[model samples]
Target chain A: MNSPLITRFIFLFVFLSLINAQDKNGYFSLENRLKFGNFLFCKGDYIRAIDEYNFVLTKQNNDTLKFKIALAYQKLERYDESENSFKELFTSQQFGSEAKFEYFKTLYLSDKFETMHKRIADDSFIESSISDKLKRLYNLKHLYSSKSIEDSSKFFQPFNQNESIELLKFYVRKQNLDNKSPALAAVLSAIIPGLGKVYTENYGDGITAFLLTGVLTFLAIDNFNADHNFRGWLFTTLAAYFYAGNIYGSAASAVLFNANVRMNFDSDLTLFLNKNNHFSSNSNLFCK
Target chain B: MKKYIYILILFFCSVSFSNDELARQYEYADKLFNDQNYFEAITEFKRLSFFDEKNVYAYESNYKIGIAYKYGGFYDNSVFYLSHAIRTTENIDERIQAEFQIVRCNILRKTTDRALQLLSQMEKDSVYSNHQNEIHYWKGWSYMISDRWDSAAESFANISDDHELKILSEQVSNDKYSVTFARVISYILPGAGQFYTGNYLSGLMSLAWNVLWGYLTINSFIENRAFDGVAIGSLLWLRFYRGNIQNAEKLAVQKNIEIANTALLYLMENYRGEKP
Candidate 1:
């Protein structure tokens, strides 16, 4: 057989090799950890799944693995972490169109619509992979949320003519420009008690404000002539203030009412669009 | 394989054991607190504190127990637990809150002397001096309850620059004067005092009615209409003069009440000051 010293050396070498292999096997292997994370994610134990996925990320160096980490964070409602991961993947270029799409989705979900719009505006290549319908929706949302109505209208021009009309109407109403028209009406009515309200489409209130103020003023004047100076002055002052305040208040009320009407219209339009569109759309789509 | 399986089972079991126990206790306590079953929540927290003496939540539990007692109107019990929380807790916020509650408990128990002493100490402390306005407000109330009107007025006047409390203090002080003014004005020119004190229309009406009756009585007497003069003078003129004086007093009183109400409304709706 072999010499005793050589035999002992060989045994020791094998034992050391076995120990090294066991050490390499890891406390929890990357693959096993990922599997555990996925299992937890599927079972809706998102918090634990995120922990496992994070553990895998420390040992693993793969884009797909990173994507899974982001998905896990998303599942856990750790939106800030998920958005950062998606943003990293989007910039890497290796992750391709799917990564870009997911990045946009994460940004949208996090209410980072402005950044999503900038990405779409800067990268022409993003449009080729994402559907035309999706692009339209994203653009619409971006426009709707944008402060500039003119810019929003320009973005919405390609979708529907009716949408343009509706948007302009909304813009006017939101800006409270409806008050200008009602103010004119109120001024006209002030010239004659119920006339301004008729012009403003509030015949009832205008008539009431006018009649009450007119009667009070007449009574006050009559009382003054009859030598009831105190009573006369009291009613006269009350009438004057009420009449002036009514004119100013009516204009303001009309503007507020129009703003409410415009808000309602936009809501109805959004609901209609959502019902007709089959692809799941986001509320931000109206922003564009 | 069997060995690995056994290791995994042990790990899972250990995790479940600690996590499940902690979560169950947390949820049970939360539910009890939410349901306003504060008494039961205190017991659970006590159990938790017993199990884990170093747990920070034990301080919270003690504080909450004091709060529950305070809300239940058990001022003595509130003071005891709140004092315990203040002495035992390391958290500055919790300690400050507990100290405040202890002071509040003393006030509720009508131990104003102790409450005032504690408030004075707090006023001296740089950390709690910012709460002096509230302290003075309560002190004023305590003084009022003790029938120390002048002291109450002084305390109220100290913070009268505070929009709401100033008005309240003014009303309390004004009530004393309103009663005096109404009686004094009635003793003066029948209704001239009422007019000077802001009852214009009523004062003029009183004066006019009284003078007319007086004039008619005098005119009849001068015309040698003795029977008519006596009847008018004794009945109409005398009755009107007395009626004018009474009206003046009533109007003055009413005006004072209106002023108090106006000040009260200002305190309730517009004053930015601290309230009881």
Candidate 2:
């Protein structure tokens, strides 16, 4: 009720009036838009930030903005756009080497391994400034699909001793891997009951197969000795059917085991490489 | 001094007018929501929340966006935005409403424990004393969705005895089969459990298979054919016996599930009750 209260009210009124046109974060100006776009980007709102960046691009051709746009594309999994952006930076003196690495990275991450190898070979033929480490990585990627890589020694030369040793073990494991041939399994089973299952490393099934066929054969012989011709013929037919089924099942099991081995090797190698960041992109100029 | 008073009146009127405009936009967004255009409504509501400087539309917009998301089956997004609205709203009533919607989303997401915890918290709040019935209602709904018919019935029983949901829950609990009983009966007598569940055809077929295999095993042994006896006994008779018991237990459980489903379907289609 006093003059001080009136003075305080006036002060509040003036402050409120001054902020009338401003938003919660203040005026929606150009600089404010850029700040908001970054704020959204940090909040994982890539789609909205892309909209703001698109607007900003209309205003200037800033190198930082271009890099940010490309990074956004990469994060959103628009690999084609990101690759194009990175490729454009390949001729820039400051970002040339870094862009070249990221360009190949895009090809690799997009599962264009064959195309990436071709590009690597073409670049190497031109004496490109690709690093030895990346060359080794590309060589391994090529070896992944190569049927001629029976010896892993030639591939490990570009790597260090520790990596070469690891690669050597991996190569030996892949080469010396036991593969049960289905035809061999089936043939062995036909020769000796349950022998095919044993050949396929299924010892329990092999023993069961031997016991079952042996029991049915004993039943047939016993029935035949008793002059029960019908029962003897029935037992003989059942034993033959079971023997044939076991041979077929053994072949199928062998095929399945080989498939499992190949699948395990592929997934394990992919996971190991991923854990080591062996295929991660590098854009030294932009990322810095 | 008189001029200053008139200027103040004008400023106050303009501020109120802006608020009215914001309310109109909110109505338009709500219309979109009511029309089942949830995706579009979400964008409109987001715009209202983003541009309203007074922040009056923050609670309404965010909460409606959460509801729209729930209707569109974006459960995780619904919960996130609903929780966000609860924090934005200073009004205790609006806060409770948002929390209730979040509990419903949790129910749909099959996270009943979280829904129950949130419901208990809201129920205990003195600010939500008037909202206790609605809270209990959703608690029952959460239990029902989780397939805990007994717990759900108990919750609805806390309300009036003649409540529609109470009757529905009671029916569901009554219709559910005793799984242990089914397994025990099947263990004692193969195919008897399937018979108990009214699967007569399956029960008879299982019984016939067991009897046939048992006769073959015993007959072979009586004929002094040890090899035939052992083979039929171990491989065929024992396998059919095990299969019969398994089939009995499975049929009983399957029947109980069908019973519970019928009650649930009745509640969904015909019962005039408040739902989550």
Candidate 3:
């Protein structure tokens, strides 16, 4: 009889202990889970961190956690998800300004400048506290994109005077890019076998082209003078191939040169902006 | 007497409570893993590893994290976590399981040298004597991934003579074109190498080009036009001759890649055996 009674007591104790476990501040509790999510967020494991945050959100409404989920998506480069998450907190009193600012930043980072520009044009959507920061991001978007900016004064309105001068240089550089024309290169090469390559700064290839064409042409004329008709015809064909090939090659070189100039300018602008933190708020503010 | 019984029950509950909680956490993470939610499963397993302060779930949590990362194609992270599993466990079988997984990750990531090194080390160990066939299997796979078909055949032969992988490796080795033979033959006979590599059209074209240019240069020399001979010999005849050799070498290499990739594709798609 006592053995049966002990078994029952053991079962009862396990059952009651499990109930207490649920009520206690254990690992699965809402509070403990929130803390764990924050820890994961800080540890740079944002994908897993989002899972923890979403779990906590299912149980309660917390603006800070919501903001964190958006920021984590941004870090993961899941911009669409980040945009939707930030959109949810647009009306939040505490995180509303930060969410609005981060939402535009997400769009900017996603390279959706057109959409971001349209959104920024709506002054009603802008929050007062983060308006200046949003304006800075808006102007930076223009510099990063291919869309032309007309009004210099309006484009530089949000930056400091010193910063404005620096940005103007970038703006001017973008507008007056040193791009060589493929048509002009082809025409020049047609006039002289290697002149286009020389104009495009490909001196080694230009010199080789000049020497190859000059030698082949001289050989064709000399063979004809010596009554070597077969060799003369062969040299003429070879010269024609080289001449046409050099013209086509010079046009390609010009196009490649222009692409490199554009690529260099874009990379330089990106490097400068990254070095200056995009002239806006630091992206690390959410974690703090 | 009742108070003494109550104290014993309370002490038992406290002791078992932490264990049960850790076990429950492990079960939840395992469930997520079974559901194919790998990212969340990793987080939960990490959480279990964090709170199981007595290390009750250490080996299990680490091993599962490794498997989850493997499933997610994160070979580097899989090796890292599986190494943790190997270190945490004292059981020989469990250690071997983790070690095998690390080897698999290395093979999958194309770090064949590392994979072969680990397999060799396992082969030398008395503790892994029972896993000889498994070691040979992975070593064969490592060789296969590196396109060393002959070595792969030799390694798989250590498992059994007629094993499917061994046979496949042998077939691949037999079917491959010899790059050196192709190059040497093309040097002797202008397009013979291309014909040997099964490029009949290219072979005919190359032979025609070489013959036409060769005759023109020799005839020019016979006609006492030394400049014509020099120009044709250096420019036309030599260019076609060198191009024949290069084409033969390139075709042989290309054919070999095709042969190896076909067998590897078959293994990936049709082989019912476990793979890295």
Candidate 4:
């Protein structure tokens, strides 16, 4: 009887120890997974971090984890998923305003300036704390979009004095872009062998065209004077080919020059926005 | 007697749950790595490193992470993690393994100088003196990737006279056209460079065009039309001459590419050996 009792007690004690071990190392427990997910998030491994965070979501709802998942989606450049995730937090007491700000930012980053502008203008869910900053972002978005902007006074009101001065240069460059006209370039080259290329700022090509056409025309005249009819006609034909090709080339060069100017202005505007933190006071809002 | 029996029973029961958390984590990470889920595997390995407070899994974790990065095409990151493994491991074999992995990564990254530098350093170290064959092997790879066929041949010849890579390198060195020679010969004779590079048709066309234009230019000057001579000489004769030189240089480069490509294709298909 005593032996059986001792055996029963030992089995119970061993079972309790196993339970304790499980408790100590619940590797996939919600708390442990959350901790691991946070580690991955901090390390910029957003994809796997989202996996771990979503794993925890299967067990329970957590606002902080949801916000992190949205931020991770944003970092991964999955704009649709990021927008949807942020939309889910729009009514949350803690992250509602922050979600609104980040959602608009995602819209801007995704190049949906029209949508961002419309949402900022019409959405009643805007928070007072971020209202000025959002409006400033709205003004900045105008620089990137093809949409016409408001007057300089209204636009400058959103930025500080120093920023206004710098942005004014970009704004003026945007307004006074030296876009060449292809038709004008063609006519100029037709009137003068290479003037259209000169108008398009291709000085070397212009000079070459002028020299080649001038030399070929002189050869045609010289051959004709010497009674070399075949040679004269050959030079005339070559000169005609070069002259017509130059006219067409000048037109094409004008179009390319305009494209280059637009590209440079867009790039400069983008760089300025990036260098100035996109004129956002809350650039680091949710990142911290 | 009952007390001793009770103790034995408890010991047996406890032993069933003896695997700790860190060990289980290590096994899980190893499973991920073996399954080739490197993106997730890196995370799991990092998790193990984080929880392993006593640094027990430092060497293994870094090594696995480095290998994972290598497979992922992140050679710089692979070198970084392998360097960590080298620092943490006390074993000479493990150190050599990590160091060679760094060399392999550098080779694949096309940083041949760093790879050669590290390999030579290892060759000078007494601990790696016995690994000269392996060093020479990777050195050959570095030279091969840098397109230094002669150096590659010499490096692989250090391993054995009949080494396959050595043979391939030597074949490439002999069969490839010399760009400078082609250019100089074309400068001397209108299409000789093209003939040397085996572009017979281009060579003949170049020679014909140059001769026709040259005769026209000289005849114009002989006929007392100075302007005609200058126009023909500058516009047609010189253009063909310059084109011949350019074509020769281009053909030589293309021929060498074809030769190197043949060797590369053979290596890819039939060479039964490790590659970078």
Best by DockQ: 4
Give the better candidate number (3 or 4) by lDDT. 3
Alpha-carbon RMSD to native, per candidate: 17.1, 6.4, 4.5, 4.2
Cα lDDT tens digits, model 4, B142-253, are 9988889999999999999999999999999999999999999999899999999999999999999999989988888888988888887888899999999999999999
The lDDT of model 2 is 0.75
- A best-first ranking of the candidates according to their TM-score comes to 4, 3, 2, 1
User: Measured by TM-score, how close is model 4 to the native structure?
Assistant: 0.88
Candidate 2 scores a chain A TM-score of 0.72
Question: Candidate 2 docking: what grade?
Answer: incorrect
lDDT accuracy of residue B175 in candidate 4: 97
Clash list (residue pairs), candidate 3 = none
* Candidate 1: residue A86 Cα off by (Å): 2.3
TM-score of 3: 0.84
Return the candidate ranking by DockQ, descending: 4, 3, 2, 1
Ranking by lDDT: 3, 4, 2, 1
Interface RMSD of predicted model 4: 5.2
All models, DockQ values? 0.02, 0.19, 0.28, 0.30
The regions of model 3 sitting more than 4 angstroms off are A1-29, A32-36, A43-45, A126-128, A139-178, A224-230, A264-280, A285-288, B1-5, B31-47, B50-53, B90-92, B120-133, B159-164, B223-235
Q: How many clashing residue pairs, candidate 4?
A: 0
Give per-model TM-scores: 0.39, 0.74, 0.84, 0.88
Off by more than 4 A, model 4: A1-24, A146-150, A281-288, B1-19
Q: Taking the tens digit of each residue's C-alpha lDDT, what string does model 3 give over B159-270? A: 8999999999999999999999999999999999999999999999999999999998999889887777777787789999999999999999999999999998999999
lDDT of 4 at B216: 80
Per-residue lDDT of A4-31 in model 3, one digit per residue for the tens? 8778777777766765464233897888
Collision count of model 1: 12
Give the 10-residue window scoring lowest on summed lDDT in candidate 2 chain A.
A279-288
